[model samples]
Target: MASPGKLDTRGSDFARLARQITDAGLLDRRPFYYAIRMTIMAAVYLGGWALFIWLGDSWLQLLVAVALAVVFAQLGFLAHDLGHRQVFRTRRPSDIAGLIIGNLGIGLGWGWWTTKHNRHHANPNHEDHDPDVSPAVIVWSEDQVARSNGLPRFVAKYQAYWFFPLLTLEAWHLHIASVKALFKPEAKRRGPELTMLVTHFVLYFGLVFTILPVGKALLFLIVHQGLFGIYLGSTFAPNHKGMPILTAEDKLDFLRKQVLTSRNVRGGLFTDVALGQLNYQIEHHLFPNMPAPNLRRAQPIVERYCAEIGVDYLQTGLVESYGQALRHLHEVGAALRRPLPIQGA
Candidate 1:
């Protein structure tokens, strides 16, 4: 069978989608946005931490701690913006705060992420070049990769085998020198790179040695990181994987891909609240600068644009999409020996 191709959105119609995004306007100051974003995360983190401390050894403590850890992941996403200087009015505060919040989670540095994440956005879905998208390591288009129907159908079945490990390892090696990692060459320096990971490592050990008993702190890291890992990892994969991989033949402008490359995760309201509203992945990618809170308002307009242009906009109740992601992982694992396609190289 032939590979599924892309949509044609270049004519007069997409001109309108482009205009709407432009009219949304850039935030006057991304740092100001970071300030507000960090404040909320701090509140969420501190509040959750207090609740966990109060819960003590009861099993409920685990639940509370788990909730706080999930918030930790959401805050990580905001800090991602700070790293890009997209969240703040100025770069300095964005870096300091992003450095702090990200410690609790992954601890990606501003200089490093600016080097890589921007490339991800600019070249999304290109097999060799777009680090953010798949390397074609696993071969399946969006529809082939996702579940067909019903809750029992998904929960009872598992499809992907690669997502969790990939999510865990994505930043594992950092930027290794190669045709790809060269885009973020600064990563070759180890000293500053390790400095960024210090905050969380300090917290984990500091809690273990000083704030709490060593046993308790160690347990907290294990349970918290595991739950937090699941929370962050699962929500993200379905957006890019399984979507048609982009090739050199494809010429995508930002607006076209804002529609093309992203998938909307389907889920209930609580899913929205917990996962940082990521179920609306397409809208988020399209207007990444817009506060995530606003994507609810943007969803309809984006949906309308996709329909008008004949783009295959994907939406799945995440309950199902989650399984789809797992299935994709398995598919990739099955093809582990194959060389991944590198975009633009």
Candidate 2:
């Protein structure tokens, strides 16, 4: 019944919990389930592409493009699971599958994404250390917003309102980031990833351009990218956005850190399928390699343990989760508006 703040994850309490969860067999890999899911998603993606091909220059092709984007996003979800080794036992096979899904299926560099995501898992919401919290167009904390200037400062002022709108460009942003990472010398053995990513773009553009005129192809690209961005961003943004952020100087045990820095979205099968069970963000952070299906089962145990240890466990509806993130952004930005106090006072 001790507070998580006072408990060390390396101590017996956490070890016992982990053992219990593992002994419960909730951490079992579900390779067959993921294999079937990926097969179906791939089929759907190709089907959507076929529809776009058949529809040609008609506006109806836009629908197929959107559908294709959705499939791509789902494939992205699978790639994420593969990266965590949730669907596979061996790291190499998981990496290979993630590369195929992320690079070829969605035009993302798997190595780049894994590197970034592993950092996030290791140090969630650490102002300086966590890449996820690093300022892009929006400042994440009061100190960050205070230090901002020019366009970023202006963007931070209205970030809460602009957040969703800005996310429409995330798909494009991710694609560009991936492409850039492929060229980075430190990205590590990226030859296969680069090839797959280039192949994705070539096939993606070649098919669209072949099926439609230049103008229609552009529109299709916009719609596809926009929808894909929203889908992907919406799933990921809620996981840790509004939760308590850590600083590089503030150290905590892994159990407390993950629990306090994460938020869970409440939903059933639909949410699980859409978010790849990342809605169980706390548990997912605690047990990254656990299969998506097993996350739900792990949730109750995690919640119970957190409750017993007096950790602040957070779960909210999808809309509420977004609102929490927005509120956090707005509050952080508010610091920029506050006038400095006189030194004499």
Candidate 3:
């Protein structure tokens, strides 16, 4: 066991790296970048809906649904940046923008998501602390496999195969979770969030139903929401899924905790744009407030510093990262997949 003094020294490792990062001006805000990005995203979003309205009572609208799903996921990425205060210095402006991009634009509750995401950043892959890894329709660890029953248990044995299929419902899960979070006693901005969510639903469904026949309208909803969920889930799945899973017993320093549990996906401009720069998961975790544009600049500095300190930094190609995550999911479910022994044997 490490002594308290040793732990303090280990913790200071992050502070030293933080100082280097601060000195590099990588932490500075990029207002112009955000301004341009938001403009483009807004244009794409509105244009998608306009195209939908233009193509009345046609199956070609499904293509528009696919396009809008990508736009919605992009909006979700913007909301994530806003929630992290990467776009705005103060909580007020950040929350305001977050609510618009998240609640009003994408039908996600900004407050609920921020609270949950903050917790995720604080403890990335901790079994007991990270809600992302908590037992749900899929179990992340053997301990969770033991505790899981009913749907979770049934799914655990084939979770890797089920992963992508289940992601189809991720958008609906998030929407339901957002609403449920509002009813919790500790929920903040409940009234405003509820209003925006309701308004979003009304505007969204009204426009769809008003523009198309009932069958087409329902199909549009399915394609749009399903692809939205898949895009969003795929964006997030690579970050930490295959990385180390921490527990109460693992007392890692801040630097190691974040780096060890996160994986980076390597790509050029297209990947950066698609993943909303979250492909640089390690840098993002280290400097949550750093603007999205600055993450690329900060990456090499972080990687070099980690190398200097002998902390293993993991980066892989986009497809490989997904493969690793799926393999991890399969490995976690190994126990559940074993054949049961006969009663007498």
Candidate 4:
């Protein structure tokens, strides 16, 4: 299929469906649900911190740290939902929530996430435009593999197999990236966000170092960061990793583009909470501003609409989705084995 980057969206039924969804108030905030959910997450996070502090130097401390990391990632998801104005009606409160959860809790810059995420939503799976898909240690497309070199090239050759193991470093990657982005001269105006991120690290490291010996602290940090990375990546990868990769030149309508490129993970309520309602990725992409809780309710409507129009709506189990995403990486990695074209031939 062609990339849907520049397609005409004016006449598409997706346009009409979007209007209907909006008119039906699906885009409205679900303050009560968010309030309760956030409260529960916050309590769990705080409880974990309390236990970690009280336990001091023990193997159980590592468990508490891992639990804290998971809770922190979920808080990040809440911040993401707030960024989309899913819980709050206005932007100010949402921004505040984003600051607290993203900067303070996760040590991620809210503005950085919002800017990058909005771009991804605007052009998800676009090889050139989506930061999420932009080549780093792992190349997701054949074109990217051809241009990669050195360590990256070596990794791309076996990226599908290495994907999960490599994610163990992603938590560290995010912290470093967030720090770099926030501390840049161009980002000085975002001092408040930067300050919160700094504060989070200071307190986080201080508590760890104070309670545990150097060796245990290091191990605790690694375990916390590793599990955190896996949790975050698992939530996001299944949404679009195995789907189509769009380029800047591809012309696709908004509806067709989002539906074709996004996949929904099939599961029950447990999966919904675990994935932060992102298991309904197609619904979330179609209505970016919709409350997370509402996505489940909107699923049947969106699915039926796609069916009537013969649009393929992708949905699969968690295991299959991960396998599919890995298969895609291997397929792209094939380009790395091909001989490079001679330049200036």
Q: Which candidate achieves the best lDDT against the true structure? A: 3
Q: TM-score: which is higher, 1 or 4?
A: 4
- At residue 180, give the lDDT of candidate 3: 96
Question: Model 1: how far is 239 from its true place, Å?
Answer: 1.5
Give per-residue CA lDDT, model 3, range 1-345, as digits (tens): 334343324438899888888999998899999999999999999999899889988999999999999999999999999988898899899988899989999999889988999999999999988999988898888888888999999999999999999999999999999999999999988899999999999999999999999999999999999999999999999999988889999999899999999999999999999999999999999999999999999999889878777789999999999999999889988998889998997
Q: Which one wins on TM-score?
A: 3
Colliding pairs, model 3:
none
For model 1, the stretches where C-alpha displacement exceeds 4 angstroms are 1-15, 24-37, 47-64, 83-86, 103-106, 133-159, 162-196, 211-216, 267-269, 330-345
Per-model clash counts, in order, read: 29, 0, 0, 2
The TM-score values for the models, in the order shown, are 0.69, 0.93, 0.96, 0.92
Candidate 3 TM-score, C-alpha based:
0.96
Better of 3 and 4 by lDDT: 3
Instruction: Give the per-residue Cα lDDT of candidate 3 at 140.
Output: 86
Query: What is every candidate's alpha-carbon RMSD to the true fold?
Result: 9.4, 3.1, 3.4, 4.5
The CA lDDT at 117 in model 1 is 67
Candidate 1 C-alpha RMSD relative to the actual structure: 9.4
True lDDT of residue 17, candidate 3: 84
